[model samples]
Target: MLHRLFILLIAIVGLAACSGGNNFSSGGATDVARSYTLADFSFAAPADLTVSESENYYPFADVVWRGDPRGARVPQIAAMFETAARRSATGLTGDVPVAVQVRLVRFHGVTDRTRYSVGGNYHIVFDMTVRDARTGTVLEPARRVTANLDAPGGSRAVALEQGGQTQKVRVVNFLTEVLLAELS
Candidate 1:
C-alpha cells in the first residue's frame, strides 16, 4: 500500500511538472530548465579552463575537457553549447534575449581503467550566468549546474564510438536536449 501511494505521488508530481510543458528528467541532466521559454540565449565559452594539476588528474580538474574532434579546447564545448542553445531557443519568440556565460569548473572523463573495467559518468561541472544578449546586463546570477553523461566501457564503448556516438556527439546531443528542456 505504501508503495502504491509513493507511485501515485510520483505520478502526480510528474503530471504537475509536465503540465507546464516541461519535464525535469532526461538522459543525465536533471531539472536544468525553467517553466517558460525565453526570447533567446547563446553559449559563451570560457577563455581558459582550470585543469587538474596532479598527474592522475583524471578526476580532480575543472578544465579537463577531452574527446573533441575540433580539439580539446573549451571553445569546442562552447560551440556545442551554442548549437544546443540554438536548438533550445527555437521557440523563443519573446523580447528578452539572453547569453549563457559558462565557466567550465570540471569536465571529468572516464580514465582508461574505469572505461575498461566499469563505465562511469562524464562529470561536467560549470557555472552559468544569464545576461542580456543585446546589452551586457546581467539577468540571472551565476549558478553551478552539472550535466553528466554515462560513459560506456569496453566493447560497448567501442560499439558506441563506431556508431558515431562519440563522447563529443553524446555530450552535444545531451546538451541540446537539456537546453531544450531548460528553456521550454
Candidate 2:
C-alpha cells in the first residue's frame, strides 16, 4: 500500500510539472537608436501607422504535433497587429505622422517532442521601425524587441496556437508602449 501511494504521489507531481506555468520575462529593448519623450517627438495628430508582414514571416508554418491546421499565417499575424495597433492608438490624444513598420523575426515555442526533451520557455521576437511619414526620416531606427511568454498547452497544436495568441498580446503591448512613450 505504501508503494502504491508513493507511485500515485509521483504521478501527481509529474502531471503538475507538465501542466503549463508562466515563465515570462521582457527581454529589454535592444538596438535602440535614442530615447525621445512625447514632447521631443512631434508628429501629426490622429496617428495612423501601417503594419506589414515580411515575406519570410511565418508564425504558423510548420506543424510539430499537428491537430487542426492553423490556416493562413500572414492574414492572421496582420490581423493581430492591426487589432493591437487600434487598441494602442486609442490612448493617444492627437494624430501622429509616424508610420510603424514591423517584421516578425523569431517565434519559438514548445512542441510535444521538445516540451520534454528541451526545457526552454516560449518566446517571440520582432523588429520595429518608427518613421516620419511626411519627411520620410527614421524617428526610431529599427530595433529588435523580444519577450518570453507563457506556454499555451500540452498538446503541440494547441500550444502553438495558444503561444501565438499570447504573442499577439505581447506585440500589441509593445507597440502601444512605443506609441505612448514617444508621446510622453
Candidate 3:
C-alpha cells in the first residue's frame, strides 16, 4: 500500500507541473522597450544657414529579408532624414547661406534566438556635415550619430517591424537635437 501511494504522489506532481499556465511552446514572451532622451547640444550656427540635401549610402540597395525588399527600406530611411532636416529648419529665417548634408553610414538589423527571447536589436549610424554654400569649405567636420534600438515581438518579422519603427523615432530625435544644437 505504501508503494502504491508513492507512485500516485509522483503522478500528481507531474500533472501539476505540466498544467502550469506559463508555457514556452506557444511562443508567449515579453521584452522591455528601451527609452531615450535628447542630449543638450550647445553649438552656434550661422544666421543664414540652411539644409541642402540628405543622402543614403546603405550598401544593400536591392536586398530583401522576410518578404520585405531593400528598395523599400532604403528610400524610407532617406526620406526620414530629409523630413527631419526640413522640420528642424522650420523656425530659422535665413538666405540658405549654408547647407547641411546628411549621410547614412550603416543600418543593421539582426535576430538571434540565443541572444534575445522575444526580439532582436537594430543599429543605425549616420553623419552630418556642414559646408559653405558657395565655396564648399567645411564649416564643421562630419558629426557621427548612432542609435541601438530594441525590437520586441513574438516573431522575426514582427521584431524587425518594431525595430524599424523604433529607428524612425530615434533618427527624428537625433536629427532634431543636432539641428537645434548646432544650427539654431
Q: Each model's TM-score?
A: 0.63, 0.46, 0.43
The lDDT per prediction is 0.59, 0.45, 0.44
Where is model 1 more than 4 Å wrong at Cα? 1-48, 52-57, 69-72, 91-95, 134-137
RMSD of 1: 11.4
> What is the alpha-carbon lDDT for the whole of candidate 2?
0.45
Model 3: weakest 10-residue lDDT segment is 21-30
Across residues 12-74, which tens digit of lDDT does each residue of candidate 3 receive? 453333232211111111231212121211222233322212221111322111212334555
lDDT by residue (tens digit), candidate 1, 1-184:
9998886576445323322221223232344443334445545545555653232313444554456533445666677777777666775555566666666666665555545544566666666676676787866667666666777768888889899988777877777776654444
List ranges where model 2 is wrong by over 4 Å. Answer: 1-69, 94-96, 109-121, 152-184
Residue pairs whose backbone atoms clash in candidate 3? none
Best by lDDT: 1
What is the per-residue lDDT of model 2 for residues 1-184, given as tens digits with 9 covering 90 to 100?
9998886576456434434544333233544443332222221211222322222111232211111235544445455556656665556544445566666654444444434333334454556567766676876676666555443434653455466744345445654554454333
Give the candidate number with the greatest TM-score. 1
Candidate 1 structure lDDT: 0.59
Which has the better lDDT: candidate 1, or candidate 2? 1
